[model samples]
Target: MIKKECCYYQSSTVKDDPEDEESIIKGMTPNPLLKKNEWGWAIDPIGFRIALKEIYARYKMPIFVTENGIGVREELNENKTVEDDYRIDYLRAHIEQMKLAMEEGVDVIGYLTWGCTDILSSQGEMKKRYGFMFVNRDESDLRDLKRYKKKSFEWFKNVISTNGKQL
Candidate 1:
């Protein structure tokens, strides 16, 4: 009889050495020096790249980014649209890092955003919205249930049309 064990590592942040002061001064500083979401998660693009490198080195397999997006408190404007430039910026930075990883010989297969349409969060919080399309609803009140394209919608459309070249 043979026994095998498999371990899966999933994290947004990956460090080579946590206690090495020299390594920390070289590049790692324990945490990302970037913006945070409503849930206090660091929006660290550099960390994403580092994680990609680490995973590829370990598994030597193509990586697929299943869920990556920012959750924010969103509201529609008078024109019935959300100017979610922040989301666009977040996606752009992460995509740029992915490209860097690919350039560095990481076999990145696919990249998928968290949500295309506003949906209930994993914690069941409606206020923490993550989507290019805004759904007309609230935590307690289900509004018209209409969907409105946010500013990032068209931007992402362009990104797709160009196959990320425009981004």
Candidate 2:
């Protein structure tokens, strides 16, 4: 089975009071320990692990993670490169959770990211970028549309080359 799980920001510190029905209905409160994206979504890796475990427990089928990534506002530096350390940290934490899930026998078959290059967001916003390769363009104008690899690109390449062992 194919599962697409996107991790959202959650707070470990704040627990919903079970007695309070409103709290239960309201769901998790967002308290980002790491950082939030441009859209204010929490960058929580634990969500990924929880999703994997829940899906595996319920379905008992091998899962293919088809889409997972973080979107952030990126800007090109003077060197024509994007130093997206936030993206790297986000992916690393999620990947670590996936690895842990695998250790716990989640039966994950494969993993794929949301996008490889910057593009229009689902909300049709170009500023909310998600990709290892930054596309040179904005919401208003398409300036050259050149592709530049972000810092996360090389880090992810190494992670893949090492089969995630180095991560």
Candidate 3:
């Protein structure tokens, strides 16, 4: 129904209203109040690893890394290519960390990223994209829809097929 445009764009460890301008601002971008390398966007990798470890230790259970995708306003090319290398880098980093965690004896399950196709932002900004398949739709206009799978999509599919060996 109403996915991103409805109320989303939140990637917080602790859930918050995505529609809230203040909350989105605080969560999406770096928190000004926070020190340069204190929290949030300061160093997402360390923070995410610590969080996963803590949570795994507490539950001591099998965990599926169910949602981990990068959001970016993709640019399409004449060949209908949507280059989202930032997203690829984002996922590669997380997958590497996840593999490390599994090596540490964490019963880590599969990791599912946030989006597979572009959608309008909860705050009404299609510009805020998070998907391998680019959907040409913005907040103000739905526009003629087009789904162009990106290199990351192919890269991800290969990674999955090779069972993390492709990375």
Candidate 4:
């Protein structure tokens, strides 16, 4: 990894706890850096650019965006389709920053979002979903784990097919 200068990079947004001494020392506070969402920090696409530039400058390496996305409160519509415009916008903004990084000579090889299908998160919950495909079952109720393609599914498909030119 060091010789090739290639590594996987993940980006996300975070806010410091008000009561934490480290946060107080660093003067970190909940700001408008990310969208306000109930699940967690909303998407902060510029964070991708900042992190990519800093890492490239420091390591001079190729980066594979391994896991980057937002967890959203998604629900199926009457037609059982998920119109996840939030997810699309989130991905588009991040990808735009990635393009900027490449323009600035950052060797970005690939990108992948977290939880491509609705699955158990690190916290083992299904409510906090980050996926292009939506699974129909939640935790503790595995009656029928039906999978449905979300609106972002075709969006991402086109992105991959066009090499992101269409996006």
Candidate with the greatest lDDT versus the true structure: 1
Error of 4 at 153 (Å): 0.4
Q: Which segments of candidate 4 are over 4 A away from where they belong?
A: 1-27
Per-candidate TM-scores read 0.82, 0.82, 0.72, 0.84
User: How much is 73 displaced in model 2, in angstroms?
Assistant: 0.6
lDDT of 3: 0.65
Better of 2 and 4 by lDDT: 2
lDDT of each: 0.81, 0.80, 0.65, 0.76
Write model 4 residue lDDT over 1-167, tens digit each, in one string: 35433333333324455565424234454345556557445355676788888888888878878787878668788878799998898889889999998999999898888867987878988888889998887767875778889999999999999998987
Count: clashes, candidate 2 = 1
lDDT of 3 by residue, 120-146 (tens): 656767777778888866777667887
Candidate 4 displacement at residue 72 in angstroms: 1.2
For candidate 1, write residues 50-81 as lDDT tens digits. Answer: 88888788777778887888889999999999
Model 2, 1-167: lDDT tens digits are 46445443343335455454324234544454656676666677887898888878987878888777888888999999999988888889999999999999999888777788987988899998889998999999999999999998899889989988977
Best by TM-score: 4
TM-score order, best first, reads: 4, 2, 1, 3
Lowest-lDDT window of 10 residues in candidate 3? Answer: 1-10
Worst 10 residues of 4 by lDDT: 4-13
Model 1 TM-score on a 0 to 1 scale:
0.82
